[model samples]
Target: MGRTSRKRRSTLTTRMTIASAALLLGGGGLVAVNVYASAQEDPGQDAGGGTRQQAQQQGQQRQVATIDCPDVGTSLPDVPDGARGRVDGELATLDSQITEAYQRLASNRTAAAQDPNFVQNSILGPLKDKRGAVLDRIGQDIRRSGGRPPQGLDGMAPCTGRPSEQPQQPSQPPSQQPPGQPSQQPSQQPGDGSDGGAGDGAGGDTGNGNGPDASDFVDIKSVQPNVAVPRNQRAASRGTFTTACGRNENGKFNPDNVIVAPGVSNGAHHMHDYVGNQATDAFSSDDDLANGQTSCRNQGDKSTYYWPVLRLQNGKDEADVGADGGGKDQNVGEIQTPSSVTLKFDGNPTSKVVAMPRFLRIITGDAKAFTNGDANANASWSCTGFENRQLKDKYPICPQGSKVVRTFRFQSCWDGANADSANHRTHVAFEDPRTGACPGGFKAIPQLVQRIVYAVPPGPGFAVDSFPEQLHKAGTDHGDFINVFDDKLMQRVANCINRGDRCT
Candidate 1:
C-alpha cells in the first residue's frame, strides 16, 4: 500500500470563539481546583465547593489546569500497512475534538465556578463520546486490514481536568555570575517589537485566559548547572556535518503536520515555523518533498525542519490572530522569529554512523507532554551565555543581555528496515543516556541537533505555540524533521562522519 492511497479530510473549521474570562479563583495567582463528578451527582452542587471556599479563604486554591487524555496514537504500535491512512486520519480528528472541547471549558469559566459538576456534564462527557467513536473506527480499520485491534483502546477516551497549585519558586535567590564571566544583558534584536527588560509582568494573564502562568518560568541563574558530557567509546564516529538553513526569513507558517496527519489540514492545531523544503505541508507526498526547493546553500539537502513557533505574550497580535492555528486556537501573541537556526548532524559516540533513509521521519519531544507525562519530553531551554544550565519542564528566564535558546537532539538509532512507524516514533531510538550506545538490532545514524536562538526581552513573557488544551506549556515543546537528502548526498554525509571530517 503506497502512502498516496490516503484521502485528505476537509479543512479543520475554526471553532474557538470565546471571549476571554478570568479563570483564576484565589489570590496569589492560584488557579481553580479540579472537579471530578459521578453521574448521580447534583448538577447544581459544586464538586469541590467546600474546598474551593476554604482554599480561597486561605489564598491557596488549586488551579484547574488543562485537560489530560491518553495519547491513542502513541499506544498503538501494530497498525497494519493498509490501515495506516485511516488510523492517522482518525487520530487527527481526535485532536480536533479535544481542541473544540477545551474551547468550551475556557469559555464557561463562570458556569464552572458556580457549579463544579458543570465541567464534567457539559465538557468532558461529550468529549469522551466523540473520542470513543473515533477510536472504534480506528479499531475497525485495523481489523478489516487483517490485523488484531489493540485492547483497551475504548478505555483511553476518558480525559480528566488537571489541577495546578502554585508557581515554582527558585531554590535560592538569583546567584551572582561566576568569576571570569562578565555580567551582560541580552542585545535587542529585530522581529516582534519587544522592549529589552526583565519582563517582571510575564507571569500575568497571557492575553489568552488558558495558560503559561507564573509557575511555568524559573530564573536560569537560580538553577544549578545540570548538563553532563557523555563519554565517547574508542570506536566512536567523531565528525560533524553542518547544514545552514536560514532562519525562516520568508515567513512560511502553517498548522499542518505531514508526518502525523498527512491528509488533514490544520492537523497540528498550532502554528509552526518552517525552515526548509518549501513544499512541505499536510498534503505533500514523498515525491513532492523530494522535488521541493531547498533553503540550504547546498541544494542537495532539501530536508524539512520545523517546530512550534515561540511567541511573545505581549498584548500585540500577529497577522493570524483569527486564523485556525492562531488566536482561534487560543495561541495569541506576536510570533518571534529565531535570531539563528543551526542544523548540525553529529555522529554516535559508540560506533560508525550510517545514512538515514531518504524520507525518514523523526519527531523529538512531546507536544502534549504537559498532560501525557515526561516519558518522551525532550525539550531543552537555556540562555545564550548559560547554555551549561538546561531546563526541561520550566521556561528559562534569561538574564539581561542573554537571549533564549531551544535545542533538540534527535534520535540517532534507526531500526534499519522501516523509515517510519505507526506511532511515528518506534522506528528511531535515542542512544542510552549514560552509555551512549544504540539499542540491540539498531544502527546509529547521523543525529540532527537543532539549536534555535531568539532575542526576546528576558522573562516568562514568551511561550511556544501549542494545542489549545495544552495551554502553551513549556514542557510540550517539540521538533519535527523529514530526511529528503538524495542518495549521493546521503552517502557523502555518512562517509564524512565515518572518516572524522567536517563537511557542509
Candidate 2:
C-alpha cells in the first residue's frame, strides 16, 4: 500500500498465467464444467480451509523486490503484501495441482472430464471462488491503502489453456509397461452417476506428468473491469430520485423458479433470500409480483430483491450438515461469514429517464463471481457500525450490536432501448461512483442498492449456506431481480425517476 515498498509485481503476471489456467480450466482437472461434487479435502488442510490458508500466508511471504514487466511499469500490483502474496502463492501452487490431476488420471477416468463447466464450477469452482474473493479483497486493500486499483487483469498472469481437439486416450493399454508415467488403469465411461448427465471420463492430457503449461490454455471468457466507488458515500444529489429497500432475514425463497439462467432448473442449485416484491420467482406472472407482500415501508412499491441464503451451522443446523470447510465445517474449522450485504439500484445521470419497461430482467452480480478466480470476484465486506470499513478476510466479525452485511448494487445505465442483453448484461452499465454520472453511450436508469445485515447473536457457530455451484464461496454470494411490476406501479416509479423525485 505504501508505494508497495518494492517493485516485484510484474513477475506475478507471468506466474498468474499458470494460476489462471488451473483456475479457469477447472481445478487442475483440465475442463471447465459445472456439476455436483461431493466434499473432498485437499490432501492436508482443515475446515478453516481456504481463508485459513490466507491468514497463515500473511507471515510467510518472501520480501523480495518487485520486478518490472514491460506491460506493468515499475509500480507494485494494486494489492497489499498479504493478499498479493496469497495470490502469488496460489498461482505458483496451481502448477502442482495440474500435475496432480495428471497423476489421478492414471488411476481413474470419467467422461465428464470433457466438459469445461463440470470441473470449473464444481470441483474447482469453490476453490477458485475463494481465491477470487481474496483477490477481490486485495483490490479493496489497495484502495483503502490509498492506492488506485487497476481496472483489469491485463499484464497480470495469462491463462490461455484450451482443450485439445479431442479427449486423449491412454497411448498404452492398462497392462502395458510404462515405468515413468503411472500405469494407465481402466477408466470409467460416461453416465457414471445419477446427477443426470453423460460423462465417459475420457482420460485426457496424458503428458509426462509435468502437467500442461499455462500457455496451453486460452482465455475463453472476458473479464469485468473495476469501477472505483466510495464506501457508504451519498450520491452527488444531482439526481433527485432516491429509493430505499428494507432487509428481510426470514424473507428468502426460491418460488421454484428462475429467469436469469432460465432452464437451469429453478434458476439455482442453491437457495436465495428475497425482500422487495414477495412473489417474483421464475413462475410468477406480473400479477404475482403486483399482489405480493411488501418488505419495505411503502406498500406501494413492489420491486423484487433477492440473493443466496446464509444459514448458521453450529453443527446442529440441518441446513448445513454436509457443508464441510465452509462457515459450518465442524470436523474442519469454520470459514468467515460476510459482515453485511447491501442491495441497491441507481438511475443514469446526465439525462433523466422514465420508467423501466414491464417484465424487464436486470442482472448485475457476476454469475462467475463465486465460481471463477477472475477480477469480478472482488466482493466487498463490512460491518454496520463502520459501514464504510472494508475487511480483507472472507467476512468480518462485527462488534456488539452491529451486524455483518454484504452489499449488492445493480447496474444503473440502460441502453436507452433494450431492457436486457442476451447474456443478461451489456444492455446496461455502471454509473461512475466518483461523479455520480453515467458514462457516454449509456442512459442512466434508476439505481437500486440493497444492504443485507446479518444480526447474528453471540455464539460459537457462524455459517452461511450458498448455491452448490458456489460450494460456499463468500464472494460468489450474489442476487437477481425481474421487474414483474404491474403497468401502473411501474409507471409510478418511472415517473419519479424522470421527475428527479425521491420514492420511499
Candidate 3:
C-alpha cells in the first residue's frame, strides 16, 4: 500500500524494560518472582546476598516479550456471502487494534513499571472494550444477512503479556512432519531451555527490541539429515510444472492483502514482496488481476504470489522507516531482496491433479502462529547444502558459501465448490500425512511449492516482517496466492501433471 499523507505517530524514545513481577502457577500454587527495574543495570550483589549471575537470571525471568491475543478470524463460523465484506473489514480492524495497543505497551514501559495493573487496566482492558464493540457489530452484520453468528467471541477480546522465555514448539507426530523433514530434536545447547540450540546472536538487537532473540537461530550443520522421498502409488500424477517468476526485482512491495482484507489499505501491517500479478493491491478485483501485467516468463500465468519481505537487523534503515507497515509498525531494518525465487507446482502422489479454479485464493501458513499456536504453521527453513534438514521455528545460521532459504509448500486439496472460504482456509486442505491422499470429498490440485533464497552474511541477523505483536517469529512465516490463470493455461497445467510430464 502507498504511504498516506497522515500525521505520523511519535517514536518510542527508549527501548522497553520489564520490571513488573509475573505470577506463575506451579504445584497448584501461585508464586511471584522478583524483577529488576532496568534492563541496562549493571550486574551487582543484592541486599539478599545474591551473586551477579543470580541477579541477571532473575531479571531475564521477568521480561515480557510481546502481547498475545486470540485470533478472531480463526474462530468465526461461516459468514454469509452478503456479509463477507463487512466481516473481513472488521477482522482487519481487529488486527490493527492489536498493533496499536502493542505499540503503546512497548513505548510505555516506564508507566507499566510504576503500576502493577497498568498493563491490565490501561492497555488490555481498553483494547477488550474496543474489540467487544466490534464483535457486536460483526454479529449484527451476520444476523442481518440471515446467518448465525458463533457465540463466545467476546471471550477472545482480552489479551495477555507473553514472557520472554523461549517460544513453545509445535508438538507433531512423526507422520505429521513434512514429507522429507526430520523429527524435531531438543536444543543441543545445555541450559538454554530453547527448542533449538543457541544461535550466534549476530542479529545484535531484535528489531526494535520486540522479538526474535538469540534463541531463534540455530546452526544448520548441527541438525541431522533426514529427508525421505514419498512413496507414490501407480496412479499418482507424478509430473511437475515449474513457473519462472522473477525474484521480485521490479520492487513490487505493498502491505495490502487482497485475499484476506480486500479494499483495506495496510491490512497486513507489514510489507510483502509481490512477484506475479503487478496490480495486486487490497482493492484489486478479479478482473483487475486478469488484465494486470505478469512477471512470469509465460504470459498466460497472471497468478499472484507474495509473502512477507525478509529484513536484516544490521542497524540499517529502509526508505519506509517513517511509514506504515515499516518503522511505524515497529518493523525497522533493511529489507532484503531474495537472491533466487523458485515457484514450482507438483502433483499429488496418489491422485490425478485437476485444474485449479480461476481466482482460487490460498494461504499456506498462520501469520499469528507465535501466540495463536502452531496448529496451522507450515514454515520450512534450511540452508542450501543442508536442505535435508528443515526447521519450522528457528532461522538457519548458514555456513560459508551457503545461502538462507525459506520454503512454503501450499495445500494441494480443494473443496470442489468454493474458490475461497469464510476463514480463508476451509476451501483448501493439505494431503493426509501417512497415506499421501487428499481428504475425503476434496479434489487434488497442483500444489504450489515456493522456495525463496537470500544471499546474506549468514548469522541470526535476518527475520521476516510480521505484525508487531507476532514478534517476527520464524514460525509465523506464511505465503499468499491467488490463481488468475486463463482456462487454457490451467488446463495445460493439469494435463502436464496428469500425463507425467515435467513441463515449464
Candidate 4:
C-alpha cells in the first residue's frame, strides 16, 4: 500500500544524536575496548602513553547522545482508506506471529546458550533471527501492496551504542600523515562522462553552494490517486515532482543500483557485508553486528556509514505530541525511505531484487555519565549457564524473564527547516543495497520521494544541504519494484474516495 497522510502539527520537531554500529558493552577485554575507543580519540597521542587513557576517555564520550520513543506511533500521510485498513490488518497479524514465535523459542535459547550440546539450529541463530523475520515479512508486504516501504519506516534501523562512547577514531592520525600530505593534492576526480560534469570541489563548479535545489518540503498527504468518480467529490490537488531532469543523475543519488546483499532467500545469512566483501569481522564477539542485514551505500569502501542520528537542536523538554503533531518530541529522529529504484534480481555482476521489509528509524540513548564506581567486569556466557546471562552479553539473546532493555547510542530527530538536505541533522535515508542489480545511470523513481527537511540548519554553521554534491542521486532507469499504478491498488483508492475519506 502507498503511504497515507495523517494530520500533523505545524512545528514538527525531533532530535539529533550519533549512532554506534556495535552493541553497548558493560565489560569486555581492555584490548577490545581500546579498539572501539580509537574512533574518536584526540590525534595528539603521547607516544605509547596515551593508549589506555584514550580508550577510557573515548568510552566516556559515548554517553552524551541517546533517544527513545516512549509511545510515539506512526505518522504517514496520503493513502487510500482501504489501503490503510489492509495495512492495519496485516501489521496486527504479523505482530501476533512474531510474539508467538519469540515465546516458543525462549526456552530453546536458554538451553542452547547454557549447554552447547542442547543447541538446535533454528532461525536467525538466536534472538536476532526472530526479529529479522518480522522485518522481512514487512518488506514483502510492501511489494504485495504495490508500493515500497513508506517513507517514515524507510531507513529506520536499530543501533548498538552512542558516538561519544564508540567514536570512530581512525588508527592513523593527522600527525602521522605522509611527509607531503598537504601538497599531495586531492584524489583525481573521475570524468568519463562528456555530458559535462557537476565539477570540482565539495559543491561543484556551478558556483552555487546551495546544490541542486528541490521544492520546499511537503509531507506526503496521501497516495490514493483521484478516481474518475462524481466530479463534485474530487479532492484538492497536492504536490508532485514534475521537472524533466528531476531525476538524480549523480552516482551517489541514483537509487536504481542500490540493493541488500546476498539477495533475500531462504537460509540467507543476514551477517554478510559487501563493502569489505566478507562476513562481518566481529560476529563471534560480545556485541554481534550479524543480527540482520546491515545497511550499506553502493560507493567507495562501502563502509557502513552513520544513519543520521536525530537529537533536539536545543536541549528542550520532551513533549509528547499526539500522532497529528508529526512526531514532535524533544528527541524525535527522522527515518526516510530509499529515494532511488533498481530492477529486481537481474542477471549481472550486481543485479538483484527481492521483497524486503519496511525499515524504521531507530534511536538509542547514552548511558549515565561514567563514574569511578561503575562495574568493569565483563559479563560471562556459556551454553551450560546461558539462561542466566544470555541477555547480559549485550547481544539480544535473553532468558525467559529477562527484562533488560537493549542500550545503544541515541539521537532524536524531527522536522528541521529543510528535511531533504543531508545536514538536516538527524534525517536518515535508505541505504542502497550494495549488490549491483541497479542500472549504472541515475533516475528518479517518480512514485517514491525521500523524506527530509530542506530549510533548517543542522548545526552552528551548517545548513540542511551542507554537503550539496555529497547527497546521492536518484536512479535513472525506471523499472518499477511494484507497480503502484496497477488496477488492484487503484480500485482500492477509488473505493476509499467513495466514502467520506479524502483522496489526493
Better candidate by TM-score, 2 or 3: 3
Q: Model 3, range 127-159, lDDT digits (tens) per residue?
A: 999998889999999999999888787688788
Which regions of candidate 2 fall more than 4 Å away from where they truly are?
1-252, 255-257, 263-266, 285-300, 318-350, 391-393, 457-463, 494-501
TM-score of model number 4: 0.20
Which candidate leads in lDDT?
3
Off by over 4 Å in 4: 1-57, 60-130, 136-504
Using all chains and alpha carbons, the TM-scores for the candidates as numbered come to 0.84, 0.48, 0.86, 0.20
lDDT by residue (230-305, candidate 1, tens digit) is 5788999989999988999878888989999898888999999888898788888888888889888889999999
Instruction: Candidate 3: list runs displaced more than 4 Å.
Output: 1-63, 166-178, 181-204
* Off by more than 4 A, model 1: 5-63, 165-203
Better of 2 and 4 by lDDT: 2
User: How does each model score on lDDT?
Assistant: 0.73, 0.39, 0.75, 0.21
Q: lDDT at 17 for candidate 4?
A: 30
lDDT for predicted candidate 4 compared with the true structure = 0.21
Q: Candidate 4 on 283-371: residue-level lDDT in tens?
A: 11111222222223221111121111112222121221221111211111222222322111111122111211122122111111111
